[model samples]
Target: MARKRGREGRFVSTVEGAEFFKVYLPQFSSHQIRIPPDFTKNFRRALNEKVILKNKDGKTWYVEVKETPEGVFLKDGWPRFVDYHGLKVGEFLVFRYNGSYSFLVQIFGTNGCKKEKFGPQNIATHVKSEVESDNDDSSSVDRSKLFKRFEEEEEDNNNEFPKRPSFVSPPSRRKMLKIPEEVMNNENVHLEAEVNLRNAEGKEWPVNIYTMLNGPTFLGRGLCAFQRDNNVGPKDCCKFIFGNQTTIDVKILRH
Candidate 1:
């Protein structure tokens, strides 16, 4: 059973068990991921040589576990799991361990929204192609260059870190903020009713979306209170990160 949270609409497992979250950081989290020591302490003994990682869709991957003095790390087959998910830096993952060796994993993008799972066949084909390409590489220098280029391109196109939609508030629009046309067209935001604008400090202000006679949408009600509380001023640019339909994280830049 899954319970939904209001902030990002992420599903939380109702089953009581040991769970831990990790933010994917390529520096150390790419090849291997260490389970938190506190979470590992829940286990009576060492983990099995292999454990099952099941996604919400019921797909499972068998990953090798390595016990070390530092902590327990998911190794070996872990890279295939990462590649299959197309996991990127800053993405969050929650691992809930059942009493058995199986763990249910849920992945979330940087926007704080749960990521959609790709079909198994598609990911398998992609990973297979990647592995074949890697094996065919003869020149180390060429392979390294190609890898660097791939990383750069991946970073540029990563949806998890997409450029935030922003607009500079003019003096006349102090009481209301217009939603960008591109933002409305984007599925990341659902402005049918209202959205809560969250700041860096985690403070939130509920603002309503108003449609004008001309067909444009603007954040009207409750925006004044948000501006007053945040000290928003003219010429200040506000960047909006749509976490989901109900929540948007806001960042302000002073002019």
Candidate 2:
């Protein structure tokens, strides 16, 4: 078998006679999607219990594969994938097996065009700031005390730290951008508020945050203007830095 490096930097073996199958999602198909019996015959003996589903943009989701008399089906983690991509009934999905235990998936809407929301962006590495101090006796003592005090305060506050940087790739057709769940929970942003989106050039766009009754929070109202002014596209990745509850620094990375 021939080996090739994958996008995740791991070497994978090329499977001979790799195949592709398409599925048309019907009503109530969010929980689990069945794989065609004929398609499973291609590599049924070689199939693994767990498989990875990768989107066109290289984002991956691990789903459990169940093989029974009923045929093979994608189980756990499938619902989250459906919800994350906002899949609806009648949408079509293409799954191409990669010889390995992974499949590259592509979603198409009713218009027969690829869904722009599934076009993922590369997630940037988390960069942590390091504190520096002068190499002096008093400076060292002060730095040690500062760290101790910081740790004590963090413990007292239940170890809640500042929100880290995150990336968002908004769909071109969508008027609002969804803030990541981790960022929203960490920042305690659950109410409607007005915030400023500042770009790298110091240009600011006032955007309104709208919290849904039981859904995710989104940046709306002024997002279109911000996207227009920054020339944001579906392929571009925007890094969001939550400077404060009222300010978000955006750095657009063009492809």
Candidate 3:
């Protein structure tokens, strides 16, 4: 499987899963299609969920559309996916790819009339914001209090007293999954890590991390639940081996 992703991921041994978190654009002469107000509204309406494919024998695919009209261009629609939506003035549709194993799509095209690459860094901010927003909505708590509390904690962390030079704090119970540096950049790399998580005790915790690949280019990233920790063992042991991407700050948005 590793060798397979390497070949498909352009010899990259890092990226896993063919476009796990990415939208797979087709290997074609990708051009742009100006947005029609109708399309803009409809594009997002069907993101990452099964939609009717253009020419499918009933095989629907998922799509990640970026509705852009201003700023860093690729400020990425997944962000103001709602605010910046305007499909009337003329938009571009690069190309599209759909997933077979899961409902996923990778779109290839331009943002604000310019070419764009579907990379991890490109979507990280949008993804992070979306995730936080989703969690917040679920809690629907006092938004003001949440922000104030978060700010206070942030400030306090910044004020933590320095420890003695000779004193080293114990390692975190979390483990970071090993991903080869080569994997982070290979556009075609597809990776899937079967993470096993165990808490400080000795109870088995479920873990699974998935990342997708673009064409034969980008070292993309995927959806992983390791913010939960990557030690797959007992529920109490603080030691683990194959885990990456740790969650430093945790917020109980729903509690």
Scored by TM-score, the top model is: 2
Look at candidate 1 and give me any clashing residue pairs: none
Candidate 2 runs further than 4 Å off:
1-17, 26-28, 45-48, 119-255
Worst 10 residues of 2 by lDDT: 122-131
Rank by lDDT, highest first.
1, 2, 3
Candidate 1 lDDT at 137 equals: 42
Task: Write down the RMSD of all candidates, one decimal each.
Answer: 22.4, 18.4, 17.8
Best to worst by TM-score, what's the order?
2, 1, 3
What are the per-residue Cα lDDT tens digits for candidate 1 across 128-233?
Answer: 4433453344223242443344346547657333454433332223444556677777765665345688987989987655544344566655677887788877
Please give, for residues 117-183, the per-residue lDDT of candidate 2 as tens digits.
5311101011000001111212323324433454565578785545454434433344456676777
Candidate 2: residue pairs that collide: none
Clash count per candidate: 0, 0, 53
Q: Is candidate 2 or candidate 3 better by TM-score?
A: 2
TM-score of each: 0.41, 0.44, 0.22
- Each model's lDDT: 0.63, 0.60, 0.29
